[model samples]
Target: MSAPPLSLRWRRRDEPLPAVAVAASGAVVTQLGADALMRVTAGAHLRACVGREQSWLVVLGDEADLPWADGAVYLGWDGGLLVPTLAQPWPCADLLREPLRRLTKQQTGLIALLPELVLAGPLPREPLDPARLAPS
Candidate 1:
C-alpha cells in the first residue's frame, strides 16, 4: 500500500524536544525515515511517515503531557485528520485510537509537535477541584 502524503509543520526542527516527547505518548504515532531522533530527549515526538492505510506514530516513551500540537497534522486510524490541540478526551480519544493504529501500520506517518495547554474535561457537570489538578 502507498503511504499518506507528507506534510510538515513550520519550524519542526526548531521546536524543543519536550514537544516531541508529548507527541510520542499522546497518540499512536509511527516514525518514518531513519531513526535519527535519538538525539531527542527520552519520550520525544519520534518521527513517522503517512502510510496508505494507517498513520503510524513512533512510540518514543511515556506521554509527558498532552500530545496536541497547535498546527500539527494528525491522521487518525480511521482516516480522520485531527489537529490534536483541539481533541477532547473520552470518546474523542477512544474514537481516534482505532484509526490511528490502523493507519500507522499502513502509512507509517511522522509527526512534529508543538506543545500547548490541555484542559481535561470533567464528567457530566461536576466540576473538578483545582487542588486535584496535580499531585502535591
Candidate 2:
C-alpha cells in the first residue's frame, strides 16, 4: 500500500504530545509542512512528534537527545535512512516510522537541528524520579 501523504503540524513549546485520539483522526489540525517544525531542548524546549495516517507532529532537537530505543528510528545527518527492527507492536510508531524516515532523509535540513559539536552536552540519562515517568 502507498504511504499516506506526509505533512507536519508544529506544537507549542508548552503543548504536550498529541494523544492517541489525535493520531486516530478524531481531532483536527490546520498547519502543514515538510520543514523542521521547532527546536527541542532539555530545559526550555521539550518537543515530540505524533504521526497518524496523514500528518506528523514533530520537534527538531539535538540528535543526542533522541534515544535509539526499541521503537525509535533515527534519521541520519548524512541523509541516510535507518530502519529499526520491528521488535514490538508499536502501531502508531510503526505507522509513522518509515514516513518520518523518508521525510527526514529527503529533507536533510532537519538533521541540522543537532549541532556539529556540543560542548559538554547533556548526556542521555534516565530520569532520577521514576514515579514522574509513569503515565498519569
Point to the candidate with the largest lDDT.
1
The per-candidate count of clashes, in order, stands at 36, 0
Poorly placed runs, candidate 1 (over 4 Å): 1-38, 41-60, 64-70, 73-86, 89-136
TM-scores of all models? 0.21, 0.23
* Model 1 Cα lDDT, one tens digit per residue, 15-123: 2223222222222332221122332333343323222232322222223422343333332221232233333333344454444445444233332222342111111
lDDT of 2 at 65: 42
Residues 1-136 of candidate 2 have per-residue lDDT tens digits of 9877444332222323221111111122122111112111124222333333333322224443432222223332222212112112223333544555455553331211111211111111332222221222
Candidate 1 has its poorest 10 consecutive residues by lDDT at 117-126
Clashes of 2: 0
On the 0 to 100 scale, the lDDT of residue 133 in model 1 is 20
